[model samples]
Target: MTTPAIPSTLDVALWLFDQSRRDDVYLPAQKLQRLLWLQQGGYAAMNHGRMLMPAVFVADETGPIEPTVFHLFEDSRPPIPARPIDQVAENHLVRMWRRYSHHSPDYLTKKITQQRCYRDAWRKGAGTVIPFEAIVRDFTDLPTGDQMVRAGDGRALKKWTPSAKPAMRRIR
Candidate 1:
C-alpha cells in the first residue's frame, strides 16, 4: 500500500486555510471540505494511487465531506495548531488551488456529487464512504491536460495552461 504523502488531513486542511488566507479569500466550511476531496482525488490520479493525506470522504447531502474537518470547523476554525506540510504536499495543494479556488462551494458540490465516486456512495446510503480507490478510478482516466481544469457541471472540461509559452506570438 502506498503511504499517504501528508501525515494528516488536518495538516493539509491547515495548509489550504493558509493558501486561502494568502489569496485574500474566505474559505467556508463546505468549500474547505469539497476542496480537500478534490485535492485528494487529484493527488491520487496524479501520483499513481498514492494518497495525499489520510482523509476519509463521505457523501454528504451537500457534497463530499471529511467528518473530522467538518466537526472541528463547522462553526469556525478551531484552535488546532497548524503543522508544516512537506514541500511535495504543498506543491500539490497549490496546484489544487489553481484548479478549484476560483469556483464557489455550490459549484463544487454540483460537480462533485455528479461524479461516479460520489454517486456510488450516495446511492449506497447517506454518509456512505466514497472509497479512495473509487475516487482514483474516477479521476485516473482524465486526459493529463484536463486534470487540473475544473470539471464544471458534469460537462467536458477544456484544458487551460496558463504557464504555457505564448503561441509563437502569432508569428508577427
Candidate 2:
C-alpha cells in the first residue's frame, strides 16, 4: 500500500485557522493542537493505519501539542498567515473543524487528556512524545472512529471551500 503525503505543520495550521475564520471564531493554538491530534488519530483509525498527517506530538504543560503548531500561534492570537493545503487534506480538515470547533479549548484539552491514548502516553512525562500507535488505538475503540471512516468515504466536507480571510472572532 502507498503512504499518503503528510502535510507540513504550516499548511495544517493555516488550514485549521482558515476553518475557524469561516466559522467566525478564533481557535487558540492550544485548542488547535488538540484538534490536529484528533484529526491524525481519527484518520489513522479509518484508513487501514494510514496517518492523515505525520505530525509528532508531545505531552505539553497543558496537553498534547505539536511543537511547531504551538510556536506558530503561541501569542494566543489569530490571523495566522494563510498557507496552501491540498484538496484531500482540506476536505478532512473541514470536517474535523466542523466536528470539534464548537468546543472550548479547555474542554477539548480535558476531553482528549481523559482519553486512553493521551493518558497512557502521558505516563512517560510532560515532554515525552505520544506515540502514533497509541492515538490510533484510542480512536479505533471509539464511535468517532466510525464517523471518520464515513466522512472519508463520503467526502462530506468537500462542500466547504477554504479561504484566506482573517479570523473575525477573538478568543474571549
Candidate 3:
C-alpha cells in the first residue's frame, strides 16, 4: 500500500493560522492539538478513515483570545491514522509551536487552546467510536480552500495571504 499524502504538521499549523485569520479569531496551541486529535480519530470516527473536523474560536476571561471549542459535525472526517496524543503533541505540533513561541504569543496561545479543546471535547463524547469509513467520507467531502501555493514541480510553498505577515523573531 502506498503512503497517503496527508498534510504535515507544519501544513496543519499554517492552515490553522489561515483559518484563524480568516475567521478573525485566535486559536491557542491546545486547540490545534484538539484539531489534530479529532482528525486522527480522537473521536470514535477513526475506524472509517480520515476526518475533516471543523473548529471555531472564542475568547476566554483573559481576553487574549483562544479557541474555546471545536465544532465536530457528524459529517466531518480525518485523513490519517490516529496516533497517541503524546506522540502527536510532543513530536510534531508542540515542537513546532515551541520553535515559534518566543516571537509569537498568539501562536503559543493557539497551541494551548488546541490541547484544551481536545481534552474538553474528549470528555464530551468526541471520542465515541463510530464507523471509520463514514468519518473518512466526511473528511474527503469537507471543503478546503487553496491556502498554499505549489510550484510547477508540485513542491509546496507558503503564500502570505495576511495583510501583514507576522515577522519571524529570534527566540531567546
Candidate 4:
C-alpha cells in the first residue's frame, strides 16, 4: 500500500490514550489495537482507500492487530516520541473514538474479528496479513459505521457524548 495519512502509529495511539484519560478510563492494549484497526478501516472506507497510519494488521487468533503496536505495547506504553497528526486525520480519529471507544475490549474484539476480513486472514493462519481492500470492504458495510442502520428514532444507536470541548491535539 501507499504511504499512510499519519506518519507514525504512535501519534494516533497517544491521541487515543489521551482521549481515554479524558473520559477517566484506562486504555488497554487490546482495545487500542481494535481502535487502530477500526480507524484504518473507517478512514479507508470513507476516504478512497487511504490508510490512517503506517501500520499493518495481522490476524492473531484473538483479533486483528497492528503488530508493531502490539509488540511495542505488549506490556505497557514504552517511551514514545509522539508526533503531530494532521488536522483532518485528528478529526476522523476523534469521531472514531466517540463512536466506538465506549465499547468493552471483548466487545470490540468480537465485533472486529467476526468480520470477513479478519476471519479470512485468520483462516489463512495466525499472523496472516489482512489486505487493506478487505478491511475497506468490511468497514464500508459495517452496521455501526457512519452509515449506521436506522432504527426507530435511532436513539439506541447513538453513542456520542456532549463534551465541553474536543480532545487536545498537536496539529500538523
Candidate number achieving the greatest TM-score relative to the actual structure = 1
lDDT of 1 by residue, 17-75 (tens): 87888899889999999899889988887687899989999988998899998998788
Best by lDDT: 1
Using TM-score as the measure, what is the rank order of every candidate, best first?
1, 4, 2, 3
Residues 106-137, model 2: lDDT tens digits: 88887788777677667877878888777776
State each model's C-alpha RMSD to the native.
Answer: 8.0, 15.0, 17.4, 12.5
**Model 3 over residues 1-172: C-alpha lDDT tens digits?**
1222233443444554454556565555555544443333322221233222332223343211213222221223234334333343334333333333233444444443334333343444534323334333333333331112223344554434776767899999
What global local distance difference test value does model 3 have?
Answer: 0.37
How well does model 4 score by local distance difference test? 0.81
**Which segments of model 2 are wrong by more than 4 Å?**
1-4, 76-83, 143-172
Worst 10 residues of 2 by lDDT: 151-160
- Stretches of candidate 3 off by over 4 Å are 5-7, 42-47, 50-172
- How well is each residue in 1-172 modelled by candidate 4, as lDDT tens digits? 7778899887888788778888987789999998898888878876777888877899997899988888887777778866778899998888878788888999888888779889999999999999888888786666564434233334424435789998899989
List TM-scores for all candidates, in order. 0.82, 0.75, 0.27, 0.80
Q: Rate the local accuracy (lDDT) of all candidates.
A: 0.82, 0.72, 0.37, 0.81
Please rank every candidate by lDDT, starting with the best.
1, 4, 2, 3
